[model samples]
Target: MLLGRHPCWRQNPAFPAIKASTFRLRRLPSSNPSLRFAAGDREPRSFAAEEMGKPKQYWLLKTEPGEWSWDDQVASDGGVAEWDGVKNKQAQKNLKSMRLRDLCLFYHSGAKARRVVGVVEVARQWYEEGDGGHGGGGDGAVDVRVVGEMRRHVELAELKGDGALKGFALLRQPRLSVVPVAADVWERICELGGGYEGDGGDADDGDGEG
Candidate 1:
């Protein structure tokens, strides 16, 4: 489903409001081994040339349902929200590697409902969050838009027992909030989530109250 730009975003009160000056937008260094970022020094470059028509990369994003649920994302202005406040170094790197149009599975990590509830498309790339100049560490953030809500929730227990998903980072590194999803794995999870059929279908905006 095509998502439009929306100006309203509801921030989690737990996270302090970040000032625009605190972060600077810069392109990822080309020397980095991963060819994740779009080439050239221009702002907001398209991936058509850099991707060479390869399947888009996929990711899994975890959030506590009570804190920031799928409904919250859909309700956000233009379905856009900043994926910020990540403190882990590895998770921060994953955020940096994200490119526009990358798909993300929105997983609810709440104790009561640990499941994949919706999908999101990366709308913006990486920007660094400063450490308040106190020497405290900061991390990267991205902007994502709600793509669709899963018809059926894919629970954690189901994935853990499925041999096909054994190697998924969500199962291996349960503590990590952000993780990469292989193309095959992404398809499989979508299948389990009630035949999502990729980007062609409309996203269900119903309350994903799992």
Candidate 2:
């Protein structure tokens, strides 16, 4: 089922709106041994993000596993695929705001599937996309590539129950297909998904399967 057909996403004002992300990264601790910025050493890869003067952003995009499962996403040509079928106004804005390299949580929604199963990177920004017959009629869409599966999946109940995530966008706007994810919330979820191992380096988003 395309996101447009997902029953839970039908437009309704019952849910509260989540604030848009308007912040950017200012500094990264140089004390971490993993990131050596000492005198003569070459800069680490993450330095570019800091140089750009824009804080990295995170998002959560919900999809039904039966319609677009993790396997399907990982196998998409070049490990990337078009993310369409969002009609919610706020969700459309979220898609448009995405920038290259932005990270997103791939969430599965439905009967027994409300969980964050993996991570993906924004490979392309939003563009004009026609309704591919799914009836989303959304403002636009973006392209995402599989980052990797989480070491552990995070369930909706867990997120809702965690007092730290009381301001989480997912819980606040349950009906939106695409929602912004606060960095802290992103880190917390990553921790719950089995440590903060998103780079796939010491963990899995790297060249190896998670």
Candidate 3:
């Protein structure tokens, strides 16, 4: 099936619009800083899980900002977009396991920015997105919406320094794009981030990017 256009968005321009150009889905962006998400607003992951009687899950998603930055995600279509492009077998397995309300940490991979900058939730469960005209099978994908951002970005160095996170999946499986996050570890990271896990939800905290 042809997937929606995934915006190959950027940040140096500051909140550029994300409109799907091809089978890859892109998101819509807003330049307004006043735009706020009330949790109840937009796509709620729990609604689907609640109706289907499925439990929530946690995970971490890593992406190189050169393709799309945190600002691109936040600005993308009211914080919602399809998280496509997983070709790795291991990572695709992780994506398939995601259920509604499954929370994920948005990790900015690559040398310049290696940190957890925000949190997103599964808006749509895993679905087969046939090659969008690409010769490859195109693997699979899922829809994710911005739930919130880390007011205080969590650095990879900090995560490595903390003895408590020794067994973190991201640490053990650095190459995996979709790594699961344990509940306790999730709390630990949030606590370490000054106890403000949902920074994007608060209008006063627009410092997630940078």
Q: Which prediction has the highest lDDT against the true structure?
A: 2
Residue-by-residue lDDT tens digits, candidate 3, 1-210:
222233433424454554456335456466654665666356657654565755567899988898767788888888887787887888889999998778998889999999998888898899877764111345677888887778689999999999999899999989998898998899888767754445434566566765
Model 2 reaches what TM-score against the true structure?
A: 0.68
- For model 1, how does the per-residue alpha-carbon lDDT over 1-210 read when each residue is reduced to its tens digit? 111222322334455555566666688787886665455445665667777667689999988877778888888889998888777888888888998899999999977989998899999898776543111344657889988888789999988888888789998899998899999999899888874535665558465787
For model 1, where is the 10-residue window of minimal lDDT? 1-10
List the RMSD of every prediction in angstroms.
24.3, 25.3, 25.1
Q: Which pairs, if any, clash in model 1?
A: 6-78
Q: Relative to the true structure, how large is the alpha-carbon lDDT of every model?
A: 0.80, 0.82, 0.78
Local error of candidate 3 at residue 129 (angstroms): 1.5
What global local distance difference test value does model 3 have?
A: 0.78
How far is 202's C-alpha from truth in model 2 (Å)? Answer: 2.7
State how far residue 95 of model 3 sits from its true place (Å): 0.3
Off by over 4 Å in 2: 1-51, 133-139, 195-210
lDDT of 2 by residue, 82-136 (tens): 8988877889899999989999999999897999999999998899967662224
Which of the numbered candidates is closest to the native, going by highest TM-score?
A: 2
